[model samples]
Target: MLNLLSNLICTALLSAPVVSEPANPKALPFEVSAYVTSENKIRVAVEKSAPESVVVLLRNSKNEILFQEMISKKELKYAAKLDMKNLTDGAYELEFKSAQGAIRKQVNVATKPVAEPARVILMNTPAE
Candidate 1:
């Protein structure tokens, strides 16, 4: 009886389910950088570990798409330029899409009122 009970206890312990922790999701292996030039153009740079074709889109605050473009190349570096001069002065979004996924970053383009040029004055002075 003692041996049978020990065997039963050992079997119960061995048959117990093992608890495991969940695994975290993998992150995207790419980096996105954006810049606004002095000429009111938005330039987005896409850098990735592998070569891929990227699709870029610009949208307004209301989620309406303003411009879209696709770039295909063998290299990992690419740039997308968007003209913001025609767009209204407000907040905007630049979205980068590729085989991995899509990433968005906010961009603000504000325009100041144009100022008129001032008159130039030329004075002639005699050297002592």
Candidate 2:
């Protein structure tokens, strides 16, 4: 009887399931995303759960406004391509504000230097 009771308790513990808490308990109603494209440009996208007014701004390291736009509430989705060709190599900030909340992202611009090809010389007088 003692061996049978121990076996039943071990089986119950092994068959139990484990539960874990989620990383983010609360969910946001809106989503924002930005990325750099191949043509030296930034692509901004925003999706909202409901139609609401949103303000988007792009500022430089000095907090100077480079570009600003107000999205109308009538639009549910928004996408834009910001030109970065004329921008200097530095830090920039992108901000989005709406009724749900606000979000900010930092971007760094840099240019790679080009390397020159090496030169080679040949001498044929020593062959005689």
Candidate 3:
């Protein structure tokens, strides 16, 4: 009987306790969208969710940087428009960097032939 109790106590003492560590969390926020205008100009819209300053960079498929600029905003959302009239038709990428996060998005710009000048007029007529 004494031996059985001793074995039980020894088994309890030899068993290890499970320990858990707290997890570390971090903030991440960034977005980018690209669109081409009717005049063949590429417009890149950048959105940020942080209040800290950020840098927007544009690069081509060859890994060559085309343009870069710094922006600062107090709000959580902000946008920056880039004009690419002189850029060649190809695939491009936009890199967004902030104090908290960094993101990249791919964009494609197609070539358009030159045409005659035309005017666009919007007429609003009230209907019954």
Candidate 4:
């Protein structure tokens, strides 16, 4: 019975349609995200449609604005970066608003600084 089941499964899988081509996703109207560094440096990215006025703001957990900037889109696309340092480690939000739309992204700066991790552990490793 196990052999029959395995043969049937293999047949069905081989007959299944193949999705070899991947569809490209459309970009959002606006986006706001932050890239935090372990050295306590935060780089904020704001992307939006061209020919629109965009307001970028960084606020603390208490909704107090820490940084604010206004950008006028005079090209086909617009992107802005904010280098934030010397800020106390805490939760914050980066906001991008315009006549088109608004996007908010959270920024978590735990007391223990952290950035992207690229290392992985294998199960075969000996227990320390």
Best by TM-score: 2
Across residues 42-94, which tens digit of lDDT does each residue of candidate 1 receive?
66777777667777788888999888877675757777776566666677777
Best by lDDT: 2
Question: Number of clashes in model 2?
Answer: 0
After superposition, the stretches of candidate 1 with alpha carbons farther than 4 Å from their true spots are 1-26, 73-75, 115-128
Worst 10 residues of 1 by lDDT: 11-20
- At residue 98, what lDDT does model 1 achieve? 66
Q: lDDT, candidate 1, residue 90?
A: 76
Single out the weakest 10-residue window by summed lDDT for candidate 2.
Answer: 11-20
Cα miss at 71, model 1 (Å)?
A: 3.1
Q: 49-80, model 3: which lDDT tens digit per residue? A: 65577677778899998888777665555555
Candidate order by lDDT, decreasing, is 2, 1, 3, 4
28, model 2: CA deviation in Å?
A: 4.7
Between candidates 1 and 2, the TM-score winner = 2
For model 2, residues 1-128, the per-residue Cα lDDT tens digits are 54333322221001111112222213444567787766667788988777789888888899999999998888889999987767777777888776656677777776553445699998778665
- Please give the CA lDDT of all the candidate structures: 0.61, 0.67, 0.56, 0.54
Relative to the true structure, candidate 1 reaches a TM of 0.59
Instruction: Note the residue pairs that clash in candidate 1.
Output: none
Number of clashes found in candidate 4: 0
**Per-model TM-score on C-alpha atoms:** 0.59, 0.70, 0.52, 0.54
